[model samples]
Target: MTTYIPQLTLPEQVFASAPASILLPVALGTTVGYSTRPKQTKETYNLIRQPPLRPPPWVFGPVWTVLYGLTGYGAYRGIGLNLTSILPGTMSVARRAATLYTVQLGLNLAWMPLFFGARRPAAAMLDVLALLGANAYLACLFFGTRDGLADPVAGWCWAPYLAWLSFAAYLNAGVGYLNGWDISDATLRRRKAVGKGAQ
Candidate 1:
């Protein structure tokens, strides 16, 4: 089977670099986490019905930081370097891997906004489900290429992330179910206000 190789643009080249690749995701994840307001997110988490085995809100930051770093390092090792000279016939695989990496990164970034910012647990659950699938495929792509490129380190980096996503999916689903699928802060406030007025 033939796989199409994509040409990397200059910005892509910068992003795929050793430092930038790793820093970008970590930075972006941190930015999104903060932009959504950590205090508010923590409050929301406390307000909602969490699933059994849900970790404290504090755990998410450090865990995600580590995962993001691992993801970045994996990209740097698996997709950024020019394998043409070292491993002939691996560029196509690397390019495809890079494309997948970018795609999965976007999927990863969308979940926080969906869950916290928009206050949509159902949508966030769906987003994480897609993210899980995409990362699974990406991990496979990183682990072994059709043309005999094998980078176990990169693939292994995704292992923890995949496991976490599984747990996250459970948490997402559990929260949605426990809350009767409605956890909107605005709705909750409106109902309270209506109750006061009626009384």
Candidate 2:
């Protein structure tokens, strides 16, 4: 049997293409997008109406920073390794895991649009519930694959997202209660006040 030898030289993209690295940029860009949806200046209330127990806006930065880094890498490694191992058409555990990952990512991206873009808290809640289901699906797929490395890592990556959305869901529900379906009129007044205050 020949001993496998390690090559000191590998493709640059191996490191460059790392999933973890992708997370920082996507997250940073997403951050910008997320922030832009808020008031024009000064500040409005926290993104949602909640008791003071709610986390500060600053907390989200640190929390998502860690979570996104882990998420991008875990997802990248899981799908990357598995996809490279087999044909796309193969019915294997890796393929299954990869598919679930894609679904979850799609749901994750949808939250911003449904909430901020459309300002539909009710619709956003529904989307988040679906997001929850997708995360559960991904977790189960990861655990069942028995791949050792991917399962727990993948599951762990999803936990914070689950927690954040859970909080957001509650906040959305409460705000919808305190406000109403169309907060546009109220929100516009608030934004104008905030923008004026900044000046």
Model 2: per-residue lDDT, tens digit, 1-199? 1111223212223323565444643665466546656453114344334433566667655665666676666665554455465444322555555545555556666766666666677887787788777666666555454432245666676677677777867776775676554445367467466753331
Q: Candidates' lDDT values, in order?
A: 0.78, 0.56
Give the least accurate 10-residue stretch of model 1, judged by summed lDDT: 1-10
**Can you write out model 1's per-residue Cα lDDT over 1-199, one digit (the tens) per residue?**
2243344222456445778888888999999999999998887877776779999999999999999999888877777763443655777667666666776788889999998889898999889998898788878877775653477888898899999999999999998898777779865566456752221
Worst window of 10 by summed lDDT in candidate 2: 1-10
Best by lDDT, which number?
1
Off by over 4 Å in 1: 1-10, 82-89, 145-148, 187-199
lDDT of candidate model 2 versus the reference: 0.56
Q: Which candidate number maximizes TM-score? A: 1
Rate residue 22 of model 1 by lDDT. 82
Give the RMSD in angstroms, all C-alphas superposed, for model 2.
8.9
